[model samples]
Structures are given as structure tokens and as C-alpha cells.
Target: MSSSLRNRLAAVVMAVAAGLLGCTPASEPGASSEPAKPHRVLNTTAQPEDTIRVRGDHTERLQAFLRLRYGDKAALDAPWKDAWEDTEVEALRPVTRRVCARDTATADGQEQTLLAVCQTLDDAATVEPGRVDLYVLRVGTDEEKTNRGGFFAQLPADDPLLVMAQRLQGQYGRHGSPGTVQIAQLGPQRRAFQISHEEHRRGHRRVWRSYIAEHNHRLRDVARYRDHLDNLALHGCDGNPADCGEGVFAVDFNTTVGDSNAVEGYWPLTVRASGHDCTGPATAFYHLIFDARQRAYPVPDDLQRDGCADS
Candidate 1:
């Protein structure tokens, strides 16, 4: 399928999940606070590095881990902060709290192999901004379960992901059940529930699109990646090969965390990862992050470009 179509489909799936689970009405358009200048904030003093493993390939294991944490909704939208070499803090909001796992393990029939060093974030902590404790794991399915036995503890009450999910669920409940959230059906291939999810996902994308369109800006030209480990690999760990360079970074355009009156709300970024050299197109797990952060930071000069076209 085309990239746009795939994104649209992903959105539909997320909306259905939201309606079923009754998530909040997603974040308000101008709810995000102003962009915070790039400052090194400790993730969380309490958070420590840890790891977990799942029984599957890298893709399945990662997807399952994401589903467990973010629910099916996150697959529709990917969230993160954008910054430049000279960014100044105008506003800051915790977009997601991720714990990087190293040397994790996962089962693959007769043998256990290290698939990926997993990073698991409490779905509840993603909403706040700051350094969060992270762990690296040798890939394995039982590692997370085993590690959490005594080490797991409570997180802050206002963690961004926790708060956002709570609020979203409340909204979804208030709106009625997932079955009640409906959208115009497109055809035999598309269902009402699917359409609704797509709409919610698009709600955020529309915000980003509008922001860029209004400002005559485009993602490849205006944004920069935070250079986290996952981001580095996802964006192609310096190789920047043509086939491995497609990526989309979505940000919220508002100022407050949950403010109900922001303008031109969502920000969906589409970056062609191929700029680094000959990397191919990169991909995001979500179609639209039904509820995610919106960052306002500048892009690095060396990374700016027009489209995801071949360099």
C-alpha cells in the first residue's frame, strides 16, 4: 500500500482501540506549553537502567512491547522532541518516559538469542518531560517479568504518559464506548470504527500539517532529531543508506500539557531518512499519535532538506 494509505489504516485501528478502551479525547490543540530550549535535564533521579526480552523477532518483540505499554494507540503515532544545535528552552513537556533495556533475551524455539536491547517505557510516564531511568537488556522474553519481581516500584503521579493516558481514557469513557465512536465508512475495505480511529489520528496530523502549511515549512527543513539510541538506529545509525532513511516525527503544536484552547494543534513530521547518504525510507509505528507531544525546536543545518527524495 502507499505510505498515505498505510498511515490512514493505522489511524483507523487506533481510533477503534480508543473507542473500545474509552481513552481521552486526545490532547487539546493548544494544550502543549511553549517549547523548552535544549537543556540537559536528568531523566529521573530514581529511574535506573533495566532490560526485558520477548519471544519473537525484533519487530514482533518491539511491537508487543509497545502494545503492552502504549496500547494499540501508540502504533498510530510516534512522539518525540525536536531540537537544534542552538535551541533555547521556550517550553518543555515530558512526551514519553522510556527505559532502555540492554542485553535482553527472547525465545526462538530451541535457543534463546539476543534480538534487541529493549527499552520499555511505562505508558503512564510518557507525558512528562525530563530524564527518565532507562535500562538496556539482552533480548529475551522472560527478562522483563523476571526483572520486575522486586525492582518494580511506583512512578510519580504526574508522569506525562500516565497523566495523558488517564485523561484520554476518561475522555473516551465520557464520549461513550469505543463502539459509539463512529466515522464515515469509505468502502468494503474500511469500517466505521476504522474510520473513527483514522480521524482521531488525523486530528493530530492535521495540526502538524496546518502548522507547517501555514508557516510554509516542511519537516525535513524545520526539525531535528534528539539523537537518542533508538532514534539513531531507527534513523539509521550514521549509515544513512538510501533504503534505510524514511522517518516521520510527530509533535504537538500547543503550549500546555492538557490545555483545552490551543490553536492549530497537531504536528506530524515526515522526514526522508535517506538524506544521510543512500539510506532507504524510514517508517513510524503509528499513523497519528492520537495523543502525543508537540515540540517546537530548530533543525540542524546539515540535516535540513526538502523532500525524502534520493540525494
Candidate 2:
């Protein structure tokens, strides 16, 4: 089936699994007295030089960089101001005038993304072969405009990353386009960068939990629960409408290799699909194998969750 269909299925299935595997309920009754006090600041920023390098001048540095910093802002803002201090010189290969998907329009299921690769500043080049193939940047409308000064570059509709983002956004009922884009090398390792669902969820859950804990009890005690509910309901995903669906989805980064850049890695991608009613949860599963090369590792047999047989 199509990748979008596969992703939706995977998300639904995983969401269910995520709910079952480790979700601590809303902490009703004396269940822990208080839901961990909301933890105030549950920091999710990755440190600079958090490199996960593979073959073909590929490193996770850029993706990690964007995730920890610019994941919430536009390309120009690049919130992780301090990371540059420790980053190696090669990883600083910044590009100019790349378009970024807008923030406000993204909430209605639209997706803003950045797809880039590392190359030498001295020589023009494309993303190194076998480097990460896809990356996404998700943000909110009201969030500050981070692009301090740079021309935005739009992506051709055929571009893989852009196509996928557009499709997914349509599924959720929104529209957007790329903002600014660029790539850098922090030393010898080349890196590709983009925003991801895991990063967004990290931010969303932290904020949601804090808001609920702080006001839920107060509202109930004062018989102002409806007031609180109305106020909260007005604010949607990063300010989108309530029906815009949850601001959570998945992103996959694949790789392609050239003959000259042979490295040890498998290129195996497994996708499963299932459906559910609109009111019920949707579910699917995805398991991929990769070689040391960080490329897709092929598998001999189609693997599925063991023990579930056809009726």
C-alpha cells in the first residue's frame, strides 16, 4: 500500500501500544498523590556533537541539532544558539534561502519540512549518497519567527520529502510549504537534518501535563471546571482547531548508496496496515533492519508480530 497509508496504520497501532505499554493513567484517587508534580521542566534537548555517524559522510548531528533547537521555530531562529560553540568547523556548512513549511498553517494537518545534506563549503555537492533521505520540521503559528535574516527556498513538488509532507498534511486537512533550508558539517562527519514527531510530542506532552495538573484540581474545587474546560478547549494544537487531529505523527529517513560509497548496511523496510472506525483508535506496525552502514537491511522473511494468525 502507499507510504501514507502505512504511516497512519503504524501510528494508530503504535499509539494503542504506546497507550498500553507505559501510559500511567491520569493518576486518579490516591494513585501517587500527584502525577509526578508535572516535573516543571522536562528538558529534551540533545547536546551538541551527539553524533551517530554512518558511512558516506553521514552523521545524525544535524537532525539532532534541529530537533533540540529549531524543531519549534523557523529555520532562521535556530533556537539552539549555544550548540555552535562546541560543533566542529566542518559541521557548520550552512545553506541559504531554503524554504521552510510555515508554522500556523501546519496545525490543520499541514507539515513543514526540511531536507538537506552535508557538503564541502569549497565545493558544490548534493546530500552524500546513503545519507538520511527524509527529515521534517514541525512548529506552531504563534511561536516567534526565528528566521532572523534569510530568503526562504521552496521545494519542487516532486521532491520526496515535500511530497510526503504535502500528502500527510492533506490527510489532516491543512496547507503549507517549505520555509528556509540548509546543511552543515561539524568537522569530518557530514549530517542531514529535519524535525520529527518524537520531538514535537516531547514538547506537547510536557506542556499539556503541566497545564492539566496545575489547573484541573483548582477548577474542580471551585466549581469552575467548565470555565477551565472552555478556556482550554479554545486553545488547540499549537492554536489550530480541535478537529485538526493530534499534533503527532511519524517520520522515516531512508538511505540510497552509490557504488563508490559502499558501506555495511541493510535496506529493509517492513510496513503493516490495519483500519478502525473514526471513533476508535487506528493501529499499524513498522519494523526496519539496518546494517552497520545505517542503510536499510533486507530480511529473508516478512516479519510480523508473532502469534497473530488469519481468522
lDDT per residue for candidate 1 within 35-79, as digits (tens), equals 645442222212211232234555565455445433353331343
Candidate 2, residue 44: how far the Cα is off, in Å: 36
Tell me how many clashing residue pairs each candidate has.
96, 37
Q: What is the lDDT of residue 126 in candidate 2?
A: 26
Identify the candidate with maximal TM-score.
1
Tally clashes: model 2.
Answer: 37
lDDT of 2 by residue, 1-311 (tens): 34544565688887898788887335466566543321111121221221112212112333443443334332333322111111333232332222232221132254433343211112213221111112333331211212412111221111111122211111000011121222321112212222211102212210100000001111111000000011112224333223445422211122222222322211233344332212222344444343443222333231221111110
| CA displacement after TM-score superposition, residue 6 of candidate 1 (Å) | 38
TM-score of model 1 (CA atoms): 0.18
Task: Provide the TM-score for each candidate, comma-separated.
Answer: 0.18, 0.17
